[model samples]
Target: MKRREFAALGLASLALPALAADAGFDGQVEAFLEALWRLDPDAAVAAGRFEFAPQITLPGSAQRDRQRAFLKHWLAEFENRSDATLSVSQRMDRAMLIAKINSDLWQLDTLREWAWNPANYNPAGPLDLLLNTDYAPLPERLKALKPRVAALPAFYRAAQASLAPNGGVTREHTELAIQQAPGVLGVLDDIAKRAAEAGQAATFKAPLAQARAAVNGYGAHLKRLLPSARRSFRIGAALYEAKFAHDIQSARTAKATYEIALQRREEVLAGMQAQAAALWPSVIGAEAPPADRFALIGRVIAKLSERHVARERFVDEIRAQIPQLEAWVRDHDLLNQDMSKPLAVRETPEYERGVAGASIEAPGPYRPQDKTYYNVTPLDELTPEQAESSLREYNHWILQILSIHEAIPGHYTQLVHANRVPGKVKALFGNGAMIEGWAVYGERMMIESGYGASPEMTLMWGKWHLRAVTNTLLDYSVHTGGMTEADALDLLMRQAFQTEREAREKWRRVQLTSVQLTSYFSGYSEIFVLREQLKAKSGPGGFDLKAFHEKFLGYGSAPVRLIAAEMIRS
Candidate 1:
């Protein structure tokens, strides 16, 4: 039978309820999301719902209780409607919505990061979004921001009270909150300037000063709590496993994925060793190769890392490489590129910085037409030594790979496709693994297609690939296996061929996050496996790479396993 016919047969095999009488289900979905947006207005603003720009969900029990009730009621409503009640497309949407609701419920009830993670309370992002985005007239945007700014004092105060009742906050999270608290002042200052430009300074002056003081006071409060902030950052095995299931939604368990990553790490290391040996004479002069394979690979990577651009040219270099990447992907016919959707390369905002060096801030599904930002953290802020270390880590070849991952045909491209997807549910509640995995898979696809085809590029790509592999290892080991700082650093710097600066940052990142690090390897591996299986099924001549990609991404940002099942069935 044909694939679509097989998909129909497969759906028929499962006994399901009768279809809904009318379009009531669609209305329910719309109603559910509208309620969700109101309860979580900051998220709504980020998703391009400017109507919620002035709202702020205060951090306390009352708000949590309300959220809990909302989620419970919606969960029952959606659960009441069975798979047979929805159309094929609506089935996918319903499944995604249910998973999103369950994840939120688990987060609010089980994990409870809100009480322990002080970094959860920052107002910088939404405030900055309102101030910076040209979604409306400057005067109107400022007017909407007034209520949110006015609520800052109570927000921080409630944040303080939220922590006291929940035992102690995690020290790392507290430190991060302290580090990022002052950045809100920058947003407030920008608003002040913008308000003045629009001749509305007086309207904003009082709230602006009050917001700044609240931010400053919040920072000081965190500093005072630092010494006593003794809660461990590690969520341990159970929480990590649960979060992996909820956030990643992978087919395999965390332990199983970790084992696969371990095997994959050895394979990558062997490949890097081969490339390093081949380049030894040219890269390291006439000296004999080091007996230890890890040492040999590390030395070659270090030498090649010297070819990176200068500090001032770091961001400029990324911008320059984007067009080249897009051109290459176009010339090669890898995947469809949408040039009309603009991608902006900019410095990472201060508030968003402690997590990752580079990220994509795409316009939410509600505002898909707005510019998608490719944020790269600037090198100027780092000390001279720190700057050089980071530059080396990014280097020439790997820098291109980074661009492939974060921009063109990576996050920027995937997100654009996500925005165009028919339903807003998948776009809003995108699976982390699917989003991250596609980018990781993009890196491999570019390399295999010969974007940079030298042994040096091969070696660097191996090293870069190791970063994803080791990320899974580091996260799994630290959270579940009780991996020490020293062991984690050794895994990154020694085995993974990362620079000292990069290793330390990864170490810090693992503490701040959990399971998210594993998404790279888990998603990439699943996607790669699925592609190979499909290729075999389609036979060599029948398979089309570009078609496969477009079809795979066309399902929106659902979990890879779900996408796999759908694609394979079709």
Candidate 2:
């Protein structure tokens, strides 16, 4: 079936079960998604709950406790239903819902980021997801904006109350939150300006002013605590392992997974070396290794960097590649193309920078016609040196692979397919592991299908994949084994073969995040293995790459293991 046809079915039948579950459990899933969203309005908005767009989540212990209770009640509901009688897809959903609730419980009880992470208190993420996505008309969305603005003061007040006393928040978290809150006011002003242009300013003016004041005040509250902020951010080995189990939703313990990443790092570097050796001289005007594999590959990669687009044109460079990427995907039949799912390549909004080099903001499942934003951060804000460093970091070959990962056959493509999955609950609560892993796998698949067309492209992908592997190593080592910034930089630069600039940024990123860095490698590893296994079993002409991807994606972003299990059962 065509993608548009499938999407129409999904939109038309969101309330219907994706599989033959105990019919009771299907209603149970929708109830849980709604209950979960009502508690965390930020999540509700992201899930395309336009009704919740105006609600800023109340930041306090009570909220967490209430959410925990909700999770347990629904978790029990799903658990009580017999898996034995369920279809493979229904069984997978059961596992995901269970893992999700368990993960949330761990975070609220053990991880307790709410007490110490000021980043969670930032209003920008929710505000951006609301104001940026055109899920509703400007007038209507601006009207929804009032409640969030009115709630801002209390939101920050709850943040103050919930945060540990005496600046117990991480210095990085506090500093970043303080930096970001002020930006929320700017978004409000932009919205007000838009309202005025649309002759709807009267509708937005009062709340806009009030929201700006609340945001400014919130910034000051954070700024005052900056001096006493704790430098410690590690979640420790025990909690790290638990989070690994929950977030990654895999059986492998954190340490075991880190070891696997370390091994993959070596394998990827070796591949890069082999590719570099063949393309030597032609790449860097040299024909042989420099006795050190790391330096030799770095030299060739440097040549690729020099061939990069200028900083001024970086965003345009990314936009220009989308068509070529789409063309390539179609020509290769890498997967079914979904032209009906609109993807727009655009500059990253001011409030969303510092998070990624590139990212995709897919329309919420409930709001299907809205465009998916392929946000590429422009180099305009960076210093000349920073801009140049970033350009080299995302060089031409690497950029194409990045495009493939973030756009064509990566996040955008998978989400296009995901939105058409009949169950709203599954689409809303997607497993990050499957989403990211599929993108990483897509990168490798594209290269294998001859997308890059050059050894340099393949080598860049090798190095990029190494970054995924090293990310796991870096996260575990820093959080569990007490790896220092110098040590992490060496792991990223020399071992992972990343640019010095890229490695430095990663040091900051690891400080900001935990287990999440590991997802790309872990998910990709399992998905790739699953593909090979299915191929071996299918035999001869039975295996179809396009069909595999479609069916795998059709599962609606469940955990990779569950997705794999469903495929195995089939």
Candidate 3:
């Protein structure tokens, strides 16, 4: 059968109460994912492991042994399955699964964050997932959550055993985990309270207390381990590149991604300089401003950033724009509208704060029918100086483009379309590069299509796009080329034209993350190129932008190259 036919057939099978698949191809894939979910039960809940929600996957040697065995079994299974025997969709699913399994093994055996990062052991979030997703009734989910919460003390004890005395975790990670641990406990405490409100607190009482104690004790475990913590959180070059291959699921190498980003950065910088020069007569006057193009661009972008929302209004302003952004996209017919797909604009969950400005909480592949939260972190926690810096970073013009990136035609838009895909495997193990790339591409797509239709918006888009480029550059440089905090700040604040607070926070982020920072640029580059190819092929008036977008998003969040091949295939 053709790919689309297979996808439809596969999806129909998913709706069945019991797992059933085609005798050969779909059967193998279904069996593998089922086993994988049971093994990694916490990840399973979000990925539609409704049956397994009550169980938490404990971290430690026993868990790792199971993970190892699982990985080896899958690799052997893949070896026996010949591509020639399978349908196209089967081949694609098998390949993606193999890559994911390989990535998992590499992450476990090689990079080994579990050996280092104590935060990986946190079980509070798993229960939160069960509570929030609404795949079942509240009572049913609460029942599922109880066992997971009850299991936390044992989970953390196993996690504690997993940590090395003198290991790889940085002091920063330990400290952050210690701080965030409380917030996680708060989620559990709230769950117990909510259960009490519903007269089910007695069911949650013992586990909730034990879970809170486990979290606090975990915090203490980290505190004791702090002196032994090392600062080298960088996954190093070889592991970084290997992890990138699987996690990113793109053809680009780390070095190639870095080089492309450098070139893209220069391209964006040149565009911003021209934009700066155009506005120079009014903004900077008829005199030579700065010798360097980077500094000159920075000066002009700062002027555009001057019109920002007040610190207090930051969250409200962003919240207020969701409806307006939705309307604008509908007005423009940017993507096929899904009025039923619930997109919620809300405060970033307390347990998930202290990260990027905003992110999307999409339902897992198995549970497609759930609310998608567009989480924007409020600025109430920041100091005055910090708040000012952050506001400057997310100024009025940039905020709209950000809304486009995170909500309108970006993450929220792409994911709604993604959920419509019949291929669960594709959505379960989405290409990070493509997922992030689509959102970054969405920013430019809106500006180019005339949202604001002005130079300032164009300038802000350029500056924001530069962040994508800089992210990759920083990721590669920090891990491989030995970029320092001073270097990172200078690159982000000066050349990238980001605010001081933003630059400092980004420095912290790069250290915590690995090749993930590179996904935005790498995916965007491939996607933008693909769009150009489509546009060129269709020719000016013949090119249907809306059709191109739907086709692009229709493939779900697979690697851009895969989508490109399928969309433009003969």
> What are the runs in model 3 whose C-alpha is more than 4 Å off?
1-23, 85-87, 284-288
Model 2 misplacement above 4 A: 1-19, 54-57, 198-206, 286-289, 540-542
| CA lDDT scores, all candidates in order | 0.83, 0.76, 0.77
Error of 2 at 457 (Å): 1.4
* Candidate 2 all-Cα RMSD: 3.9
**Local accuracy of candidate 2 as per-residue lDDT tens digits, 395-417:** 88888888888877887888777
Residue clash pairs of candidate 2:
281-286
TM-score of each: 0.95, 0.93, 0.93
Instruction: Write the residue-wise lDDT of candidate 3 on 1-570 in tens digits.
Output: 001101111011112112333457777777887887788776777666679877666787988999999899988898778877664445556777788888888888887888777666656556677776667777887887777778878888998888777655777677767867877977887797778777898777777888888888888889988987985877688878888888787777889888888888878888888898888778878788887898788888887777899998887898888888888888988776676778787887777665576877776666566677778889998888888888888999888878888777777777767666655777777778888888888888888778988878888888899999999999899988788899999999988999998898889888767888989888999998888888888887988888778767766667887777766773
lDDT of 1 by residue, 1-570 (tens): 000000000001111123443377788888998998888888788778999887878988999999999999999998898777665557877887888889989999999898889898888878887888899988899889889989999999998888853338888998888888657787888888988999989988898888888888989888888888877888999999999999888999999999999999889988889889999999999999999999999889999999999999999999999889989999999888778878899998887778789887777777667787888899988999999999999998999999988886778888777766655777777777887888899999999899899999888888888889889989999998889999998998888888899899989998998898999999999999999999999986999988878888877777898889877877
Model 2 residue 428 CA deviation (Å) reads 1.2
